[model samples]
Target: MSPLALGALYGIVTIIVMCSGMPIAFALGVVATSFMYFFMPASSLDTITQNVYEEIASVTLLSIPLFILKGAAIGRSPAGRDLYSAIHAWLSKVPGGLGIANVFACALFAAMAGSSPATCSAIGSAGIPEMRRRGYSPGFAAGIIAAGGTLGILLPPSITMILYAVASEQSLGRLFLAGVGPGVLLVILFAGYAVYRARKEYRLAHEIYSQGGIKSAYLDDEHFTFAQKVEMLPRVLPFLILLIGVMIALYGGFATPSETAGLGALLAIVLIAVVYRMWRPRDLMPFLNSTIKESCMLLLIIGMSLLYSYVMSYLHISQSAAQWVVALHLSKWLLLAVILLMVIVLGFFLPPVSIILMTAPIILPPLREAGFDLIWFGVVMTVVMEMGLIHPPVGLNLFVIKNIAPDIPLSDVIKGTLPFLLLMFLAIILLCLFPGIVTGLPDLLMGAR
Candidate 1:
């Protein structure tokens, strides 16, 4: 059969397997390995195995599991709760104070967690109750949490960025650094919108206040001693240390992405055990179990993607697709706009990992040939993937927020996300127009590296 014919068959089978309710890992692996065994040399099986192993064994890929573990550990500890309390206390006086705090806190947590579901679950659990209690609409609460959760991908140390770096043979450190600027920009935009909405709707000022809980002096209660306020800062110090240490290491070139993740995971454990006093020796078993479970799933999906990529290569599918795209003669920016739109649409049905793994092989070379900056493209791709996380129907973040705020209807969750979604789009547009926003940090970091 012609290469085009083989590629077409592979695509059709892939969609069928995915739509059949089978796990993506099994579907991708089964289809790819079956095709390779039947259409190519039987010995190709060895090559596929080697390829999968190499892909999974990379130093950069190590960051994924570590980040996952960090997120898991923090979720199970008081550090997350404490952080939420502090943010809530400070922002509660605004119009949509609770919802606005949810956006900022989620963004901060996203920088550390590097996973959307985890960020949504952690911050939503705390923020949702507070927002509802403060008289904010439940739909608005869930929607903000869901929308903010997308920062897990946009922020540095993002597992999605690490995965893309591996898939595209780009630098993990560079990708991580590149994400920082765009991530901050998005957070500012989200916060600004929150402030504007709160002011217009509630007529509040943009005043900054010190962080405090219900027990603080700002309330009707008696003020605590200076010693007590000073003591609370120490309770929050672990998180500050984790953030500062990771960013400093990344900037100073002291560690690779995986190493930074390992450090993060280590800090998370220490925070739980030492700072939160929640991690007893007995908790280790469940911690390890959860880590293994999540790690296994990620590795399985990754293994499948590798095998699938091999099959696509054997069929010359990516080559043909790249040729066809180049043949279109569209300007690079226009083609990217089309690709971004498609990604947003596909995101409604597929997880970001599946989308990136399946499409990166087909789409990347054409993007490179079109003279697009790989680093900028990686950042843009992340933003697009994040959009999928907050979009309708299968938006995992939305569901997470809903679970946190059970009283909120699904339709309300969808409606609340619309404004945040527009902000996300604006962030993407800004990044596209000024590629430096994504590349500047990476360039500086690489020089240090």
Candidate 2:
């Protein structure tokens, strides 16, 4: 068979295997190994060993585990719960105040968690119950949590950004910096929509406190004395400190991305273990185990992506596909808009990891060859990928909220996410129009790097 034909066959088979319940990393390895054995220039066993190990040995990729650990540690902390409570206290008075708070809380959690499902599960467990108790419709609660959970990849320390950096061979640190603006904008859009809904339906003007007012309940109440507030401050202060500290270090070049992640993870563990005593040594075992499983899953996908790209490269398929894209001679903006639309559609079906691993290779090279900014494309793609988390049917976030909030119907979750999804689509367009919004941070940082 011609290399192009073989490459196309491999691509189709890989997707089929993944969709058919085969593991992605194993499927790619099997396909690549099979291809290597069957094609010309038959390789020795050592060649396979060397190639696989080399791909996995990249230093740039080391940041994935550190960042993943950092997110997991924080997600497992008492401080995380306190932070959620603090956020809820402030935003609970709106019509769907807890729902809106879920979005903002997800955004904040996204900064630390670095992955979507983790963001969904953590926030859903905490925020979904609050929304349920407050009389928010179940569907809306589930929909909001599902939709809000997607912020994980758009925010800093994102595993998607790390993977993008690996696939595109771009700077990890710059990509981290680049996601900040778009992530913040998404949170604002989500919060605004929630507030709008509350006003329209519930006539809720402000968040309500358990005891009618913040001062009476928080300040003079016997339930929470002055000393208790001081104690609460410790639980509260670590989250803020970690956020500011990580950003400053990244922005100032005080630490490389991996170094910063290592620092963040170490600090997080200390904050949980010793500082707050929320996590004992025994408690940490489960979190560590969770982190390892997640890391392995991500790394496996990445390794398989490397092998798949290698197969495509050897077959000259990536180049051929780019040639076909260039042959169309389409306008850049029009082409990008079409691609973004496709991503939104795909978001409804494919998980983010699968989408990023499968589509990025085909789309990214062509887009960059057409003179679009890779950094800007990264942010746009990440946003579109996030949109999938809330999309109906297979949306993982929806399931998370549903699991946490069984009383709310599935339809309400879908309805609640509709407005936010529209807002996300708008955000995609604005980022496209002003590529500066996405590119500026990365460019500034790249120069420094």
Candidate 3:
């Protein structure tokens, strides 16, 4: 078959298999192996095994597990709760204080956790209940956390950015720096919305109660003494310092990504031990077990995604698709919009890792052809994926919120996320209008990619 025919067939088959509910790794492997066996020569087949091994055995990919472990250790300990408390205490004087605090906490926690579901679980477990107890709408609390959790993959030390770096052969440090600006922008946008919603909702609730209607109480003001705020920071400072240390090490060229991750993981363990005093096997093993299982799953998916990409390339499908895309001669901006939409649709099904590994090669060529900066595109793609995480039917973060706050209906969680979802799109538009928001920090810090 021609490359176009092969590309169409491969996509159709892959989608059908993936939609059949098979594990993504297996589905990719099965489709790749079958396509190679039936459509390509047998002599080249041994390369599949070799490629899978080599693709995953990178020093850079080594950092994924360590970073994941770092997230898991602190995620399983009291770190997230303490961190949220510290931020919450400081934000006590603000309207929609809890909501704003949750967004900020998620951003800080995102740097540590690097996983959306983990960020949601960590912050939501503490923040959601407090919001609920203070009479904030359950939907509002769940939505805030579910939306905030999406930050985990956007901030520095993010696994998604790391995966994008490896796939695009971009600098991990630069990508990390690049993310800082847009990530902060998103945090601001999300928090500003929180403030807006809080004031509106609280005023409405107050008006109802004034008429003897007794509507729900909105925790409009959560006062805290300076001493109380300072006290919470002591517990939160260690993890914040760890995050700062790891980023400086990466950006300053003090260490390789793997080395930095190793140190970060080590420090995370020690902090949990000293601060949370979780030294026992019982305390650490669950984190270890969870990390190992998650790491293995991701590595498997990565290995197979490489194989799938190879199959597309071997079939000349990737090159053909790129050629086809470029041949359209559309404006780069229009082409980029198409690419962004494609990834958003993919995000509805696949996790970020699989999406990056499987699609980056095929899409980057066209993006580069359009003179687009791959690093900037990576941030834009990540933000779009963040939107998918809170979207319906398969939004992982949405389900995470429901799992953590069971009494909050899934419908309510989805509804709550709608506003933040709009904020994410706005973030994307801002990045497009001012590509500098995504690129300026990295270029200033590292002199551009």
Instruction: Summing lDDT over every window of 10 consecutive residues in candidate 2, give the lowest-scoring window.
Output: 215-224
TM-score of each model, paired residue for residue: 0.91, 0.88, 0.98
Which has the higher TM-score value, candidate number 2 or candidate number 3?
3
Clashes in each model (backbone N, CA, C under 3 Å)? 0, 8, 0
- How far in Å is the alpha carbon of 376 misplaced in model 1? 0.4
Per residue, candidate 3 scores C-alpha lDDT tens digits across 157-182 of 89888889999999888889889899
User: Top lDDT: which candidate number?
Assistant: 3
**RMSD (Å) of each candidate, 1 decimal:** 4.9, 4.8, 1.2
Question: Which candidate wins on TM-score?
Answer: 3
lDDT by residue (1-449, candidate 1, tens digit) is: 87777888888888898889898899999899889888988888888778889778878777778888887887666666677766666655554555567788888888877778888888888877866665455666677788788999878778788788888888877888888898888878887776676554332211222333223212222234555545557766678789889988876888877787888889888877887676666775666677889889998898788778877877788788778878999898898988888788879888888778888877888888888888789899888888888887788888887777777888889888888889888988898888889888877757633
Residue 339, candidate 3: Cα error in Å is 0.9
Per-candidate Cα lDDT values, in order, are 0.78, 0.74, 0.90
**Per-residue error at 250 for model 2, in Å?**
1.9
Misplaced by over 4 Å in model 1 are 46-48, 93-96, 200-231
lDDT of 3 at 189: 91
Clashing pairs in 3: none
Tell me how candidate 2 scores on lDDT.
0.74
Question: Considering TM-score, where higher is better, how would the candidates rank from best to worst?
Answer: 3, 1, 2
Q: Per-residue CA lDDT of candidate 2, range 1-449, in tens?
A: 76557767877876677677767678777777777676636754347666666876977678889888888887766555676776666654444556576887788888877777777778788777766555555666666677778888878888788778877777777777788888878888877777766454343212343337332211221133455446556666777788889888977889888788899888888877766675666889877988899889878877776776776677677677667667788898877877777777777666666566666667787798778877778888888888788777787777776776776677787787887789988998788778778777777766733
Over 4 Å off in model 3, which ranges? 219-221
